[model samples]
Target chain A: MPEMYFSDAIRAALDEALTRDASVVLMGEDIGPYGGAFGITRGLHEKYGPERIIETPISENGFVGVAVGAAMTGLRPVVEIMFMDFILLAADQIINHAAKLHYIYDGQVKVPLVIRAPAGAGRGYGASHSQNLENVFLSVAGLKIVCPATPADAKGLLAAAIRDPNPVLFIEPKALYGARGEVPEGDYTVPLGVARLAREGKDLSIITYGACVPLALAAAGELSEGGLEADVLDLRTLKPMDLTALEATVAKTGRCIVLEEGPLTGGIGAEVSARIGERCFRALKAGVQRVAAQDTPIPSATPLEHAVLPSVAALLAAADRLFE
Target chain B: MPEERLLSAYRKMLLIRLMEERIGALFTEGAIAGTCHLCIGQEAVAVGVAEALELGDEVVSCHRGHGHLLAMGGEPARLLGELMGRQIGYCRGRGGSQHLSAPGIGLLGTNGITGGGIPIATGAALSAHLLRTGAAIVCFFGDGATNQGVFHESLNMAALWSLPVLYVCENNRYAMSEPVCRTVAGGDILARPRAYGISAECVDGMDVEAVEAAARRALAPLRAGKGPAFIEAATYRFCGHSKSDKLLYRTREEEAKWRERDPLTLTRLKLEKAGWKETLPWIEEEVRRQIAEAEEACRRSPLTPPETALQGVYADA
Candidate 1:
């Protein structure tokens, strides 16, 4: 089989979803004929027609609510927010309505919707476009947050999300879209809330997701040369985190380092550290260290942006601190 | 309308009015916390539209939603228990009158935000269309909600999709002291929806029969899977916007004029003229019984524990 780019994997998953279920539809700004901004939904409009590949107005709140309503009624709508930054416009429907509807209704109603958006810095999109908001959604309950770094995981996780009974926020790393890797051709699904071991090690555990996963893997490879083998865990799903896998890795390594593209304060790393402290308190060797972006907006300058965000070097430094 | 159905309409309106009155008394006595937007004079709109709907059909209401709940055959005791912040309430007392839902009776939910339920109803209608179910959704909003951007967006989508939805605009003339004339730049609310390609009409909301007739005609397309419909019912609310509201905007004479066109009285007159003499007393007794049961339920219900306050924030657990 031919190797597929991460973006093509997403398109394949969407195509499969549309082909399998008539109720599954796609809606977003400039998504129909123009394809997606990153060309993830190319040729879907012509194949599915207007009803399934809907091109909506720029009103995020309006369309998001419509998707919520559509999802609640029976349609599994995969809505795309042009960028992760624009999701702030539809916060009410996403947070208050979609997130709480099921629990508020005592599980009587289900909002089986998927919101896909591109997240993380490295594109030089500046402060507005370059953001990792998985932490923000990690705070919200009733929502499943998935950040897939590889092409195969992207396709598998998206398929699982569309089939899942609850609402899922699927954040694809924009930096990794053009990157290519091997992916299966037939139908497949990757279970949510489960972390994947990118590489095996026993000296230290490195937990990360999205764009940081590849960087963490690179850091692990480099650390291995320095006689320190780091166990790299890719947290595919942020909420309902695979704490079991995390605890097992932490128990073996006795040290952990969290790598994130978002800010250090109130980041997902904070939540992970808190939970790990509560669960594996005695097993932890020094406190868990977080290697994340500086507490500042992402700058437009390439050098300044690189200085703020965590790179492979920063992850290596954090791991060294965990051992010391 | 049949003699029995006419009496049922009158009784439902009376029950809502009397229940609102009881809620008002309890609110003033400090038994109920938070704001209560009572649908005192707008009983006709709720009862009228509800009469034409099937048991499986859904309803999404606005802030002033007591009448909407009661009209959909919601238990007054459970609703009152919610208002009184008791665990036995519809939302486990987490949501007050403004956020109540009886999904079993097809009352999808009520929203506190003006024009919020519009999209929800549109979604519900879209769901019905997708599932091929004949269950149309009746979305109730005040005349004030007509100016909202969401209202227009939802109506346009419903029209474009031809979903099974009925947008019922309960035009009581005021959106919390802002008159319809000042709020609405357009002439008629019915025309606004009609511009969206939906078949719409204005009805005498004060007359139950007129409201039901309009609903029956509008619901035809939805039942046939043709598309959605809109109805603008010109009604009135006797009370202020909320419990803490002071009557500074409208005059006493204006309130009295609308009071004369009371929906309950109009329906009762129609029932009596049809030779149903025992209708009034029976409705009064039923209203009294419901109020007593609601009050008793409120008194006996338990309060939600503080620790469980954050329990339902997510569906994972």
Candidate 2:
């Protein structure tokens, strides 16, 4: 294992899939010579040539649908939406076609497609560009949502998503793209619908995924110093959620906090907490809490954005109250 | 040989007409759980395109898709059963009229969403183009669907990438109740595909042979990997848009005029001109027998179990 940036880990997965399978292709705007908006696919165009790494003209709806079609016809296409904000344009294809085609046709087609897009707020990208839309797809039955926390899981989860039989939405936390962590060499996969414990503790459970995973770890570190240990659970795949691991952590700690970067109402936190309240009610010593963004749109100003998104300080404060 | 060709085309168009009329009856009887859009006057377009396609070549259809499915070799009994929400249906009773699909027989899918199947068809062409599979795709959409953004996007990408897809727009004069003239910008769906640089043509959708010939010509360029082609079939739907449509949008005179140019009638005339007039009675008998058998099959099929509804949400699950 060697330390690598989270962005590079994703690139590595794409590179490996393209090399290993002829059906694998990269499609997006400026992914070729431009190497993608954030330069994640920078050198891939030069390596794989223009045909395999396709460049389109800002038509997310068209290309994502093309990926769905290709998936049905034996081509494993990995489509990149430059920013998660633009994913709304392609939502029709994803939800109506890609997600339902398999079931709609009574298992006649398998849409082995992956749509990778960078999401979340850290930079001042304003309302549309900085929002996390995982909640939009959380309830879509055929769609699988995977958010990687570490460099290792970034490569592993993406590899698994690419090889998956169903449609997968690979949401990248843009804030953590440059974060450095260890990833294995060559190919590997972190199975979907499995949770990983970022840190081991007993007093309380800190449940989170994607960008919030790192923040939960930081909060747990502060809690640990104050003689309050917490279990930080990283949910790698959110759709076919790993309830087994989630309940285990909550039942072990008997207290939990659900954290997400999306808006609070009908968000990931709300869904997870409702299930936790039902199944893990007897295991709880304290009421289940949620730390998420406000129901307002993400702002452009740094301070305002900070107030909107979940923070490590907020996680700690929530943990302190769980003890009281 | 030409007489048999005319006869075969006549049979498919007649089958769609009769089958859809049966589906309408089923809808009225409460046997059909969901709404179904009939392609009564537009059979030539679907039957013709499917006739021109190779065995492995696929056809993707829009909401008015039962014709496309049947023309592409979908079993009538199974399609009827599926529409009736029976366990022994094409989608195992989950998908109904709008979602009819038989992938193994090259009927890719029928989308409920307008303009949704355009990209899927374009992508199938892309897969064929990339893999050199030589399987061209035929996407059947309505005049209304041409206004959808994906229609423009799919046509552009298909032309840009040299994908082998034949985009057939069944301009049935109206989208539910709104006429295409009012809904489409510039009132020309044909102009849209041409602007995207695709090889385009318009044919009288009432004449099965004319549509079949146009589709055959389109497929030659597509199969050669030249690029995508567009065929605007000037057809009309004889029935109302759905089970609930009251037919208030058009005058009865207009509907009667289009009915005179009905695909089945036109194809029957073609058969008569080919000196197959004596065989018409026997052909009619064969069609009636098949439709009756299909109706019986679906009626006999048991209701789909409730638990099975939860089964297909995920392929792996």
Candidate 3:
């Protein structure tokens, strides 16, 4: 295994998918010689050429709908929206056509496609460019939402999403793109609806995913110095959440804190906390506390950006409530 | 085109007219629910274009799509079952009239949204081009759809890549009662695609021969992978936009003027002029019997079960 940046892992997965299947093609803006906005697909274009790695016009709705149509007509198209915010323009196709085709067409057709977007708000990219917008797609029934927090999971989940016969939204947190982790080179995958237990403890569980995974791990590390241990579970797949892993960790610790980097209202943290309250109420020893960003648009200035998003300090403070 | 081929096209146009007439009656009698968009006077556009299509050529239609569905060989029973929301429907009752599809004959679907199927048709053409499947796609949308940003986006992409697509714009004069004059820029629908570098033309949508000739000419360059072509079929809808529309937007005088040029009456008159005058009565009787049979089969079709709604939201994953 080699230590690879989160972006390299994504490129590796796309490279592998294109090589393994001829039906697989990449359609997006600036994914060719421009090396993509974040350079995740930097060199795959050179290797695959223009046809397989299509360079589409600056029409998000056009290309996204084309990908959906291509998916229906026996091609697996992986689309890249430069920024997550721009994905709003193509939401009608993603929600109306690609998501509903399977049911509406009575399973006669399957939209086997993946949409890769760079999301989240740690960078000072301002409100529209840096918001976490996957929450809007969470409730869409047929869509599978995969948010990878590590290089290994990013590669594995992306590859799985491409091969899976459904529309999958593979969101790479911008903060995690440059983060390095041990990743196996070829033919690797992490199944949807499964969680990675990052660390184990008996006192409490820190449930988080995507960008918040690192912060939760660091918070768990700090708590150990004072002899207060915690269990951290990274929920890589949001829509089909890992109920078994969530229950086991919460039942063992009897105390839990849900952490998310997005706004607290209607966020993934809200969904997870509600599920815990309903399913694990009898096993809990303390009320479940949620650590999340304030309900406001992320400011571009560094200090204000830091104030609006979740932090390890916030996770530690939420952890302190487990003892009280 | 031979007289027999003309007669066959005439029969299909006749079938679509009678089928819709029966469908309209069904709606009035409360046998079908939800919205119904009847393309009664626009049969020439559907049959003419369908006649020009070869095997494996798919079609994407709009809300006013019963004609297109029938023209592309969607079984009358399945389409009727679909309109009635029964299990025997094209989508197993999952898709009502507007969303029904027959993949067997390459009628991909009739879309629920205006201009929604343009990109999908473009994508299918892209797939055919890449895979060398030798398939072309025909997308039938209203003139009202030209205002959609996606219609322009899809046309731009198709022209840029030379994808094999035929964008057939049935300018039925209105988009749900807002006539093209009020909505489109200068009401110049053909200029949109022509600006995108696609070859566009206007055809007499009321004349089956003219519409079919235009479709055949359009398909020639498309099958050769010559990007996309656009055809603005100047036609009108005999019925209101939907079952609920009151026809207050236009006058009976205007309706009667268009009705005089009805596709069915014009095609039948052409056949009559060609010494096949006696065949018209016999052809109409057959069409009536065919629709009656379809309605009988629809009555026999089972209702959609409540439990089926939960199935197939996602493929086996």
Candidate 4:
């Protein structure tokens, strides 16, 4: 085991994917010499050269569609849409073209394209740059959405996403880029659609993912101090959302809280809460409690930004309500 | 060009024209379910451009794409079956006329969304370039697509990476009701690619030989691994944009003017001048018979079962 930053883990995963498969190419703006906006692709470009490490212009729709096309023909193209907010520019390609190709073309083509985007709040990048759009893509049928919360999961999930036959939207939490964690040495992969139980408990379940994983874990730890043990599950992948695991956890613990950093409306938290209400309703527990950002644009100011986004304190409060 | 190839191209264009006209009638008769975009007048561009393509070359087409499939040697029976929602259709009846993909013939797809195929074509080109597949891509789109952001982005990528792509812009002058002049700035469709440093040319789309010559010239450099090229085929659609269009935006005089340069008639004149005096009627009769047989087969094809709609969303995912 080795301690690595989330960014380094992602870099390692990309390196492995490119080295293992000659068809795997990374395309995005400022991904080559500049090493991307967050520097996740720093030295990979030097190792892979210009063809594999393609630095595209500010053409999100163009490159994303190109990735779809390339994936269909022969190559596996991983497109880095610098920010999650910018995925809107490429939505038509992702939703209308890439997502529906398999179904519409009747499985004649497989779109093995991965669109890597940094998502989540609390970076003070304001409304445009910071926001989690995994929930938005969850509605799309054929695409897979992966939101990894830890360094180990980041490396594993990214590797799996690249190898998956269908298109996968890999949303990296920007706030967790520099967070360090113990990652396995070589050939690591966490299967998509499986929930990672960060900390298991018998009293209550705190279901969360991406940036909110740490906050829920911290809240669960704090709740333990107050004589309550909370089960913290990190939903590594959102679309193929480990519902079987979620039902099992919710059935055992009975009490559950859905935690996320995005807005409360139509968020993944809502979906989790609704599913818990539907599947685990017979298990003795209070209603599902959700802790999420207020329904508003993430402001640039530090205090305001922190106020709108979910905090450890908020998760603690929301978890306490699950027992109440 | 030899007489046989010329006659074959002319016959293909005629087939497309007849097929489109029959599809229009079928829609009116309530036989075809969904709306259709007929490329009745722009047959030459499809026939000529497709004539330049080889076996492995792929074409990404726009919504108005029956002509593209026909020009690429697509069977009319399968295409009409697609329109009629038969199981033997290219997409197995799920994708109506707008989404026609013949992977066997390398027809990538026909997108309903405007300008959606440009980047896909670029990616296909990149795939060829990376894998040394020796395959070129031809992207067929309308003039309205020139205003799209993806159009500019794809062209820039094609130029930057020197992808083996030929961007064929069928400037049919109107996107739905809005004329290219009214919508696109400066109304110079070819200038957009020329500004992107791609070798661009505006060809007489109504003339099959001119379009063929231009496409050949563009594909030469593209085949040699040089970069992407653009050809803006100045053409028109005699019918409305879609089944919903009322044709109120453009006057009858303009339509009459474009109809005079009908691609089939232009090709007929070429064949007549080449001393094939008896060829036009014979070709027309052959195309008519072929289409009728295709329609008969299409009518005989079975409709897809409604329960199998959810069958092919993912492949063992």
Interface root-mean-square deviation, each candidate: 2.4, 1.3, 0.9, 1.0
Q: Provide TM-scores for the models.
A: 0.91, 0.99, 0.98, 0.98
Q: Candidate 2 lDDT, tens digit per residue, B201-289?
A: 99999988899899999999788878999999998988999988999889999998988988887777777887888998898899999
> What is the lDDT of every predicted structure here?
0.87, 0.90, 0.91, 0.91
Where does candidate 2 chain A have its weakest 10-residue lDDT segment?
Answer: A312-321
Chain A structural similarity (TM-score) per candidate?
Answer: 0.98, 0.99, 0.98, 0.98
Report the lDDT tens digits of candidate 4 across residue range A251-314: 9899888989888999998899888888889994788888899999889988999989888888
Candidate 2 similarity to native, TM-score: 0.99
Write candidate 3's Cα lDDT for A39-142 as tens digits: 98898888999999999999999999999989999899999999999999999999999999888989888899999989999789999999788778989999
B221 Cα displacement, candidate 3 (Å): 1.2
Residue-wise lDDT of candidate 1 within A123-241, one digit each (tens)?
A: 79999998887777887878889989899999999999999878899998999998899888879788998999988999999988888888998998899899999899998999879
Backbone clashes under 3 angstroms, per model: 0, 0, 1, 0
Which consecutive 10 residues in model 1 chain B have the weakest lDDT in total? B308-317
Q: Which residue pairs show backbone clashes in model 3? A: B162-B227
Checking candidate 2 for backbone clashes, the offending pairs are none
RMSD of each: 2.9, 1.1, 1.1, 1.4
lDDT of 2: 0.90
How far is B205's C-alpha from truth in model 2 (Å)? 0.4
lDDT of 4 by residue, B1-317 (tens): 68888898999999999999999999999999988999999999999999899989999998999999999999999999999988778987888989989889989999999999999999999999999989989999999999998999999999989999999999999988999879899878878998989999999999998999999999999999999999999999999999888899999999999999999888888889999979789878888999999999988889988988977676565
